[model samples]
Target: MTQSMEDFITDAFEQNYERIRLETGRAVTPNIKEAAREQVLLYYRRMRDVADGVTDTEVKLTLPEQRTPQQRKFTLEGVVDIVREGDRTTMYDVKTHLDADAAAGQLDQYVQQLNLYAHIWQGLRGEALDETAIIATRPTRELRQALRSGDDRVIDAAILKWRPCLNIPLDEHAVEDTVQRFGTVVDRIEERHFMPPAVEKLKAPIRPGARQPFGTAVCANCDVRFTCDSYRQFRLQTTPGMNPERVLQDAMNEYAASSEQGQWVDANMETLNRDRLPDAEDIDRGDV
Candidate 1:
C-alpha cells in the first residue's frame, strides 16, 4: 500500500521522540514492540510438544460500531504458531528465524504493529485486552529474558497516549481545515523558495567498513538502501565524509556549546543522538 504523508511524519516523530527518551533517561512509551513479541512467544510456548506444528494462522478480530462520526474500523491479522492447551482461545507468535537480541532491539517496531493490531482486537472483542505477546524459537535465552522483563502496564499507558494521534478527530470541517492549513504552509514554503538551511546541508556520506543493513524492523521493509546516499557512498569509499561518528561528535559538540552559551540549539539533540544516529548504521554502515 502507498504510504501516507501523515504516517511518514508521525513515524519519524515517534522514532525521534522515543530515542530521546532512551538517551536522556526520560520516561517515554514503554516497549510495546517487545510486548507484542512476547505475545507471539506465548503462542509458541503452548505448542512446544507438537513437533512440525502449525506454520501460520490468521486471526480476524471484528469491532463494534462507534458513535463517533468518523470512527475507524480495521482488521487485526495475527499470525499464530500454537493455540493454548485448554482454552484454544489464546495464541502465540513464535520467532523461528528472527533472533531474540535482534527482536529486542527492534521491539519498538514490533510494539507499534501489536498496538495497531490491539486497536482492532479491542474493536473485535468489544473489550480492551490485558496483554498481547509473541513467541519465537530462536534466541530462546534472550526471548526468555525479554518475557521476564516485559511490562504490560507501561505498554498500555503508552497506547493510551498514542491513541489520540492514531485516531485523529475527524469531525466536520476537520479535513477541510487540515487541507487549508497545509495549503498555507505550502504557500509560505513556496514564497521562501523552499531552500534548506545551511546547517541542514550536512549530507550523509558513506565511509569504509560500513555495513548498510535493512529489514522489516526499520524502514517498514522499504528498499531504502539504494535510495540512501550514504549507503552508496559507504559501499564505494573507505572514508565517507558524513560518517555518523563525525556527525554525532559534531552534534554533541554543538549541543554542548549551545548549552554553555545559553543558546538555543533549535534541533532536538537528544532525539538525534538516541534515534537517528543508531539508525544511521542501517542506512550507511561506515565507521566514522
Candidate 2:
C-alpha cells in the first residue's frame, strides 16, 4: 500500500518525538500539516529525480532506527527534490506555484530548515550533505526574468555554512545545544515575537503588466489572515475607507517602540529620527 502523506509525516514525527519529549518534557506539537508536507514531498521527489538523473525508485535516504542515548535524527518536513551523485548530495525545495522571486527572497528560512535536518542526519550517519537548493516548480515569468539578471549569492552563502557542520563532532553537549536553540526559536514563534515584517511587504502593490496578483498559496490559507488587522484592513479598504497612510504610521510607531526597547541600534541621529517622527506642525511649519 502507498503510504499517505499523513503517514509519512506521522512517521517523521515519531522518529523525533522521543528526543523532543526528553528535551521539553512535553509532547511536541506537530507543526507541518499533512497538506504542506505532501506538497513539499512531491516537489522534493521531482527535484531529486531531475538533479540525480534517476527515478524515485533508485534514490534513498539512509534513515536509521532510533539508537544511542543522545543520537540525532532527521525528520523530513516538506522535502521536494533530492539529487545524489556518489558522496555529493543536493536537496531542492519545491515551492510549487509560489512566486519564485518571493520564495528566493525568503529562501534563508528554507536553507536553515535544510541545515537543521542535515545536522541531524550528519549526527546519525557521520557524513555531511553537499548542498541545498530551492526550485520553483512553476515560476512566474517575472521571477524567471530576475533569475536571468543575477545569481543568488545569499543562497550560496547559506549553503556554504552548512558544509562546516560535517566535521563537527556530535556529542551530548552539541545535541543539547542544538535542541535548546531549536526550542528557543520555537518559543519565539509560539509567542509571535518572531513575526516577520507586516503583510504590506508581502502584498506590495503590483504594477501594470507586472504580476496581477502577488501572493502564495500559503498566504491564502494563512490562519492569521483574519487575525492580522493590517491584512484585514487592507482588504476592507479596497475603496477610500481603509487608510494605508494610517496603517503605515501605526506600524512604524510600534516598530520604533520595539526597536528602542531591543537596543538594536547605537545612539545615533538615524536612531533618533526613527524614534521621533515629525509632527504635522513640525514638518509644515518648517520647525526643523
Candidate 3:
C-alpha cells in the first residue's frame, strides 16, 4: 500500500529531527517542532506534483576563468538541483524567503545567480537548458496561522491559496555582466575593502524594486550587524527623537541569549534608574 503524504511527513520528521537533535545535543521546543513540520509539509505538498525527473540535487557547478582588474583568473562556485527529461534540463534553486511575494521582490538577484549557473552548465557541461526556477520553502502566514489554529478547513483553504514555485526567466545574455560583478565583489573581498552601505541606504529598500527595507530584511539576519555602524544608525533612526542610551538598553533587553548565561544584562539595566528615561516620564505624565 502507498503511504499517505501526511504519514510520510510524520515518519520523515521523526527520523530527520531525531538525527538533528542527536547531532546538535539540543531539544526542539514544541512550537519550533510544529513550525518545522508545517514547513516541510508545505514544501512537500507544493513540490510533489512537479519534482519528478530530478537527476541531481546539491549539484556543485564551477564557473571558470573569471577575471578582475585587481586579480587574475578565478572560479565562482554554486550549488543547484537539476531535473531532466530526455535532452532538456531544468535547474531548481530553493531559498528560505518569507513567501512568493517576498521572493518576487528580489527576483532580479535570483535571475543573476541562476544566469551564472546556466552559463556554467552550457559552457562547461554543454547542456541544453529548458527552464530555471526558484522554490521558496517558507509557508505563508495565513497557512501558519491556520495550522496553529488546528482547523482542518482553514488549513485546506490556505493550502489551496499557497504558491511556492516561482518560474524565473533566465537571460543568458546577462551572464557576462553578472560574472563581471561577481569578480568585482571577489576582488573587493581580497583587497579587504569591507565598506558597507550608508545608513540611509540601509533605511531604504534593498533596491528600488523591493518593498522591504535593507535593515529589516537583510541587516536583521546578518551575523555582524551589531558591529556595523550603519546598522547602529539605522536602529537609532527607527525611533526618532529617542534617547540613545534608552534605545540601547531596550535593544539589549530584547536579545534572546541563552538562559545559562548570567542575567548581567538585566542586572546592569537595573542599576540605571530606567524611570528617568524621557519616554517613560512622558508616558507617565500622559497617564496622569
**Candidate 1 stretches greater than 4 Å from native:** 1-56, 61-78, 85-90, 94-97, 126-130, 136-224, 234-288
CA lDDT for candidate 1: 0.40
Cα lDDT of model 3 overall? 0.76
Local accuracy by lDDT, each model: 0.40, 0.46, 0.76
Q: Order of candidates by TM-score, top first?
A: 3, 2, 1
The TM-score between candidate 2 and the true structure equals: 0.39
Please give the lDDT score at residue 175 for candidate 2.
43
What's the CA RMSD for each of the models? 21.2, 21.4, 12.6
* Candidate 3 displacement at residue 131 in angstroms: 0.9
Instruction: For each candidate, give its TM-score against the true structure.
Output: 0.31, 0.39, 0.76
Q: What tens digits encode model 3's per-residue C-alpha lDDT throughout 132-251?
A: 999888875566787788888888788888888888887888888888888888888888898889998888885676667878777776777777888788888897889987876665
Off by over 4 Å in 3: 1-3, 17-34, 85-88, 206-211, 249-288
Residue 55 lDDT, candidate 3, scale 0-100: 86
Residue 23, model 2: lDDT of 57
Better of 1 and 2 by TM-score: 2
- Model 2 per-residue lDDT tens digits across residues 1-288: 225744665577556654554554443112223334434443333333453353232223343342322344333333334456777765544455554544554444555555655555556656556765555544345433443556666333333322111121223344444444555655565556745446565455333334433333244445555456655454444435557676545544543465553343443333355446689989899976
